[model samples]
Target: MSTPARRTGRPRSAEADRAILGATRAALVELGWGKLTMGDVAARAGVAKTTLYRRWAGKNELVVDAVAAVFDEHLEAADHGSLRADIEDVVVRFATLLERPETKTALMAVVSEATHDEALGARVRSAIVDRQKRLVLVGRERAQLRGELPPEEDPAAAARNADLIFDVIAGSVVHRLLVSAEPVDREWARSFATVLLHGLAAASSGTGTAPAPEPAREHRQKPAGSV
Candidate 1:
């Protein structure tokens, strides 16, 4: 068989790509989704509009990637030695991200539009929701290792439980922050983690009363910065 000819083109700059995404986030913060434009992002990124379009299909796609990047930046798992502590810690971190005006605004806008747009929905699922779910998996694995949770006889059930936990954690935080227009702070996170831990304990023991979860310690986090 004949070898195919090598394609020739200049390589895209990774630095420029990071700059563009950072610019998109800045635009969202300053102008919001409605007011933001390709020209604005290009100028903020110090790149041509063509450069952005060359990388991303449109504003929606670009914003999705930008939001995903921010989420990735904040998605961290700290081994706090106990399930309750770990859950509370991660929940506080997540709530911190939710509290950000830029992330909150952009995510809700994209999600609202995603209801009607299949491609956007897929992007949000793959980029945002799925990535965040890893927090649940990691926590679950840690809990099992510590004997905080019982071993699963069925892998399918374990997966389902993880999904349910993810939904409860993420959905409650979103609803409280966006719909209820309430703040998700340390107290709220600890309470939520308490309820979650108790439920998991009951499930594992098949009993009405479970041991009280360890009190969650305060987590001091730094602010997110621009690139």
Candidate 2:
């Protein structure tokens, strides 16, 4: 996500930044990602086109930051008192956010496009995915503190465990809500959470273990100038 740039070497305007991102999402609702443009967003935001150019290189970066802003604001994990409750809260919350017309349409469009654009994919992962992963980490720590989970002796293993949990939660919600066109209400959240927390807590207790990942078959060559 590109930071909104300073205007003519002065500090950036938080108000203007908010307006621009707000305008972007609003535009996505009306026009969808294919038809939204920087000029259109600037017009909606009541700002000069140059103001947008100063902050973002183009539409891809702008839309990404716009969507990122929404996720950051709306999708935080609340203290639900238990891992199951937290998972249920997060799943329902994520579903509710994606149910919004602007977020549903815009995020799906950008993610589809990002499949072919590595840099854009990384931006989506960093700006959105990584931010959500932190919430998972926070919730996991809370579970540990409550004695709902044991502390992994290896830090690296703990990190991997968190990553796996995040993938499962995100994948299940996105597939159910978006692809399956199904509801993700409290009942569904509870059932799903029960299943997920079962294997998760079981593994931590040594009653079950996650299967070993298959070894990588190969490494693809990185693109030029790629990180």
In the range 6-122, model 1's lDDT, one tens digit per residue, is: 877668998998899888887888897789999999999999899888889899999999889989988788888878788778888888898888788788878988999999999
Q: Candidate 1 regions off by >4 Å?
A: 1-7, 200-227
Candidate 2 Cα misplacement greater than 4 A, ranges: 1-8, 200-227
Candidate 1, overall lDDT? Answer: 0.82
Residue pairs whose backbone atoms clash in candidate 2: none
lDDT of 2 at 223: 26
Query: Each candidate's lDDT (Cα)?
Result: 0.82, 0.83
Q: Tell me the lDDT of model 1 at 221.
A: 22
lDDT of 2 by residue, 1-227 (tens): 99997666757798999999999989988988788899999999999999999899998999899889989989887987867778889899999999998888779878998999999999999998888898889887776666666656798999899899999999999999899999999988876776686655544554333332232224222324757
Worst 10 residues of 1 by lDDT: 214-223
